[model samples]
Target: MRIEIPAKKRLVHETRVPIRWGDMDAYRHVNNTIYFRFMEQARIEWISLLQQSTHTEDAGMLMVNGFCNFYQQLSYPGELIVKTYVGAIGRTSMDVYNAMFLTSAPEVKVAEGGATMVWVDLITDVATPWPEAILAGLR
Candidate 1:
């Protein structure tokens, strides 16, 4: 049986990442753990963009959960285009979705994943409300 996941409604950010030799496993394909790294890069880029545009202070976010589903194997000596999308938003947390595609074959999805990030106070390490400017930018 197959399950159909709904398409992302909007893409908030995207960035290109080159695959390094160290990213591969003994099987010569990108290690599954590396896919999470790709997602993290995209998420950081998204936050950086927001920070630049809004000029907001670094009130940080923490990832509470993450998941990835691999559809195809990625080899070294290539680059990937990582795309990020925002999903549900709450008082202090939000869902982020990511999709990775080979730069050479944009239409082919190599892997996809998501993470839940909660707004937090950097010093206190406690949950905090999302700033107005950042929230506006996210929407």
Candidate 2:
């Protein structure tokens, strides 16, 4: 199925995560690496919620690839709200999109990103088709 990445109307889930001291960079702002962490948190939350609703586990979803675009800077002692959603559900993988905005400056979008995760067998570490439960939950 073709899914248009929503321009504004839909945000699958929003999560608030605190900026920790460990996240501070040499410039004294939340490190660039930390932004990826925030994205991961958002993605996991989405996956976990979907799993809970479907009575399944997230171990089946593996992070095969991901990326981020930093448009603005965020400093310490701030809260980040991460918005996430399923961008597409393919035969063996799914794309999860995300956007991060500083709660302190709700008007500013700090970053936008997405990732490709493949359904896999943890033991075998091989790609597999999207599980029926996950596909159903996406709908």
C-alpha lDDT of all candidate models, in order = 0.85, 0.76
Best by lDDT: 1
lDDT of 1 by residue, 1-139 (tens): 2223347447889899999999999999999999999999998888888864412366667898888989999999999999999888899998888989999999999888888888887777788898787788886
Instruction: State which candidate has the highest TM-score.
Output: 1
| TM-score against native, each model | 0.85, 0.83
What global local distance difference test value does model 2 have? 0.76
Error of 2 at 74 (Å): 1.3
lDDT of 2 by residue, 33-112 (tens): 88889999887787788764312243466788777888887777789888887766778887788888889887788888
Q: Note the residue pairs that clash in candidate 1.
A: none
